[model samples]
Target: MTTSDGEAKGEGIHAWHRQAVNDPNPQTLTATSAGHARRRPDHLAVICEGREVTYAELHRRSNQTAHALLAEGLRRGARVAYLGRESEHYFEIALGCAKSGTVLVPVNWRLTSREVDHILRDSDAEVLFAEREFRPVADRLRPVLPGLRTVIEMDTPGSLADGFLDWRAGHAETDLDPGTGRDDAVVQMYTSGTTGLPKGVVLAHRTYFTLMEHMTRAGLNWYDWHPEDRSMSCFSSLHSAGMGWFMVGFAAGCTNVVMRMFVPEEAVKRVHEDGVTVMQAAPAMLRMLLAEPGATPDAFASLRKMIYGGSAIAPPLLRQCMERLDCDLAQMYAAAESGSVVTCLAPAEHTPDNPRLGSVGLPCPGNEVRIVGRDGEVLPAGRVGQIHARTPALFIEYWHQPEATREALVDGWLCMPDAGYLDDDGYLFVLDRLDDAIIVAGQNIYPAEVEMALAEHPAVAESAVVGVPDQRWGQAVKAAVVFHTDQRATARDLMVFLRGRIADFKIPTQYDFVDDLPRNPTGKVLRRMLRAQA
Candidate 1:
């Protein structure tokens, strides 16, 4: 084991090592609730859909929940899956799993029943927690999955004799320690790979604590958390973007406003009415929120910072958010395997005209980013290649997939699925996913770079680029474009608009006009779907 800087792994203080220094802060995920409860018993910890949960109440409830799990014969490292939207019960169950040393698996509600069954069976989940919305699907799959022993209803009592509240209330509230270690796995999130097969990414307890404490101790204020700040959990907990941000809010002892789902109108209302000071949203979600008629500057006046990631944001939309919201803006670049934010574009560098805006900012303290050529050798600055990251907070392995794990983690560095490069100034420029790159005449062409160029045109709304077989060029660039309702541009017009912005060889030779682009649940363009259509 080694640190990102090639030093001995534990040469410096780490999140787990902080306890040895006599620090009072929490070092593990379970302690987040216990520590905050003792400091501010009555302070609101979670607020969702008119329901409020204080830190003390959350602690006591989570304690009962943990006892209930143990009483159900679930041993440490058992997989407990939750199928539902974000709610107070979801966080309660997460903390309960953390306390009981069980691994929590969150199922995306948008997934098909087959996908859900695959995850449930693959993880060998013993206990399932389902909200009312997904009860039907849960019921259909329960009898089929032999390993699934228990199903706890989230909204109301369904297959189980007692609902989530009744079941949780049946157990005693006395806090119990299961001797969980920082190295123990707490959460297992499934990532759908390029083949559409999902692999569980196993994250340890320290994954959530160590890097955060390191950055905080390093005095990095890219995104600050204050006790008075109210943060919104807008992204799905199934994804790292939502779960990581939620954990961060809890670790900081701030109030977290959880949304059932991201509705542009509802998100806007929450921002104004809930007095949300911090928000982490994807660029596509931000675009929809800004398009709402109610998304006035005053509606966002309460926001202290707007953090966007998950995918690239067009500079035009980025400028719109900065101008309309009138708040500090930040960008995060990371993967679920990385455990925490690897690089961040801080508020100080968010100038509209800054050339570095194309960059994803510098690496966080104690983290390292390097580009590697196909031969596994490091590349110099400004050359695009595979992005490899080394950080204290990283997933231990892909659950039950040793070969895949070996391929991803090489020599203490996690090879990111995406392709990118590091600038001379240490900033990161992410081009596109390696799988999504188009090879034209032995030259690499990134779709995102072309999409960004198209976004600069006033008539272009959104676009997706893919490669089509060409007899002469090996593969030629083709674009599926959607224009703004009030704007229109010819294919020649777009070709001319992108003439100087990008290379002539990278420009799309053929274009297909469409109403909109297809995207997945997290607002990422479905390039594979576009490729098949092409």
Candidate 2:
């Protein structure tokens, strides 16, 4: 098979990509409740802290929430915002919005009042479900955001709330469906762009369903789920991957063990006590988990698979996770706009010294990957270009941003702002984000490639590479590094070690010793912050 350009297509277009088993498939996001409530009424749906919610409870509570939202004058398709950390209530609001045909917009609790206001106003959300801790911020922004009509305060667990719970309890618990279809938008997720302002990526119910169908149909062991599997949702729902992960578990009728926050020590304790079998986390989170004193083979004994992504992982970190955790490691490469995990490094590919470890692996079923050059021409094998994908699970559009939408969705392909190449066997090797590339003396330098070299150094704990203004070369490579607690290294030592590891120009001309690299809530390195500081 070949592409339109007459070039041999990647492994993503293989014959088996269309195969499917004769199992029932959910047609909408609301099926997470509507489908599961009937199948596993008494089974545990969500376990958070000391609280447990069964499938029946989730359905009933979320239905009550849906009735409340409609009763509060929220029309179908209206944006409903949630400003709080992950909790059982958050899922209720999410599923309720899905049931009521209101798009769920999860605000990053870590954002400032101003940033939160921007998202609320930008999304034009009518109803805001906020935790008591963040009520002050919500109150401060309400008068300014005229579109924000209702503010329902969510109380802590077991407390009779005068706001969220009380209002929800007043509504009917009977199932109320608003006729949300597969094409209806379920979530309007805001992602920080290069401009630093949040852009809402509106995802439809079909986004989740399409990905699930393809993954299930392919019969891939990379990310399978079972009803008895106790999966962990450690990442925040504001992160799309976290939301998708939670939905995947819910749709599979699995018992989700929720972590209100990602504390390595606490995570180790939960895995040991709860018998969690499958979970996903970022590489940084895995590193922290392995660093904990209680993190032993026995601690993760019941864990069968660990799916990781969010950023490019260093080989040392990957090897550490494979060795210390002693479990199957699957690496996913995806963006919110492209659904989740278009490309994945399966467990079998996690070999000790395999070169394929550097690649993000072949595309998943019903997904196509292509490398396009600056001139919009399709690049041949082994040629570096912008990575693009045609996936069945692509987001609808960036809310109200027509120009941005047109720019992102080109010729039916979701454009990823990343630079990479495809090998002959169709393996994708991601260098780094094209915007993060440092141009030095007409040579393109990718930070991930340089950071990979720095990881080879024994004393380097973590490092972030960024471009600094150079009087001679326009831009010079700089690195901010954190060393191991018991070890230390000099800039000269690192430079000497990286001399032959990567291109000389790609090596950092200057270095800063820091306690840690700045990261977002999702554990993605804030390279823009590093560049601003440099």
Candidate 3:
């Protein structure tokens, strides 16, 4: 009943399965999904925007997409950037790239041309799959991304050159053995940088199933998906939840209800119409779904389990959601660099009378997470410190940034800036302030990155950004600035200027004009004091 470290077991849920998690030869997800297609070819594998795509169709089309890419001269481990929302085409392209030994980089469609250019250039992605709506931004990026010669538009109104279906139709199903190894990179997710630019976290294909398989061997029920389960994925495809959960569901041979964009009313309606049993939703989305007109407890009665995390949920809201949905609530805590869900708050501990509801449950099977102090020593229970997680799911490296990778990943552990504490019961409490990184709608917005964007305006002397609690987005970004004495700038003007530099979610929703910013004796800005004032 203990981990390899000899720590007492949290849920003791490991005895449910008697098999092993790791394999002698691990490989890309294409193998797993392909097996399902062979075993159950006629099964409904994907349902998106009133269309149902079967497993056989998905596998065949992905093979074609892979062939299309190989014809364009993409080699093993070439990066392919996808700039669009959730769709069958997105999933097809992802699996196709994996089959071809190419890495898939899903870019946030909300980002500006500058942000998109930074990611494409940083990852050196040779091909881009963009939707028609983002064609203008793609056009702007083509001048900057010199190596990016291939652009396949999904859902386009124009000719064959600008659309994906036309491009994919020209190629046959590629049965070529790409000979991809387990350690090969498959996806590169960009984390908003603490420095001026974002850093791409390179993850191998094994990450999608490693933690879940380990949890399965350990007897955990919530870490996996069932073949009969209808899973709804409404989160932004750019985030780990969107693509990560989809791949998990696909591996399980489940029918996934994919949302092109998360419109709260439409999401709830789909859950009801599709008989969605499992879902990966954010707290904000859940709250909105519960508040929609004619939304009753019965509307969500079919849901068997709901997995949510990212931002901290208010106790009353969490309790309300569990009661309204009439389903077991599972909370998972993880980040892009960590690769997969490291800690899972099981459904059994979510009762109103349980004190453990405040915590993010126990660490999941096969991951090592410890709270370390300033002296690099592990802190005891109930003591808050930065969390260091050592897992097989950890990103291979921050793409091309050796110094940053070395700085973040030491030895085998990803030493995260997120601060929290584990109680004697092994329950982890992830604080709202995840190391000055403001999470707005599950998107990570680092204050340092936002402050740098604000300082770009000539009228601003200095700026500080902080996360203020918001009901809708969980946390909203706010700015406090000391303007240049001779210059004039309104809050709106600064925000307008910043909107051009950073993503909209990173831009401050509110601003405060201050004559001076508080500082310590060493002259470092006292963010804690600023937080206290806010």
Candidate 2 local lDDT, 189-217, one digit each (tens)? 88855437889999988776566567656
Higher-lDDT candidate of 2 and 3? 2
Q: Which residue pairs show collisions in model 2?
A: none
Top-down TM-score ranking: 2, 1, 3
**Compared with the true structure, what per-residue lDDT tens digits does model 1 show for residues 196-301?**
8678999888777665566655645445676788999568877877998988788777899988888999999999999999999988889889889999888988
- The C-alpha stretches of model 3 lying farther than 4 A from their native spots are 1-24, 158-162, 192-196, 437-534
lDDT of 3 at 372: 84
Task: Point out the higher-scoring one by TM-score: 2 or 3.
Answer: 2
**How big is the positional error of residue 10 in model 2, measured in Å on the Cα after superposition?**
26
Model 3 Cα displacement at 321 (Å)?
1.0
Candidate 1, after superposition: displacement of residue 383 in Å?
A: 1.3
Which tens-of-lDDT digit does each residue in 421-525 have in candidate 3?
Answer: 899978887763456867789987767567756766777666778888999999988899877668878878887887768888888989888988874321235
How many clashes in candidate 3?
1
Off by over 4 Å in 1: 1-26, 157-162, 192-194
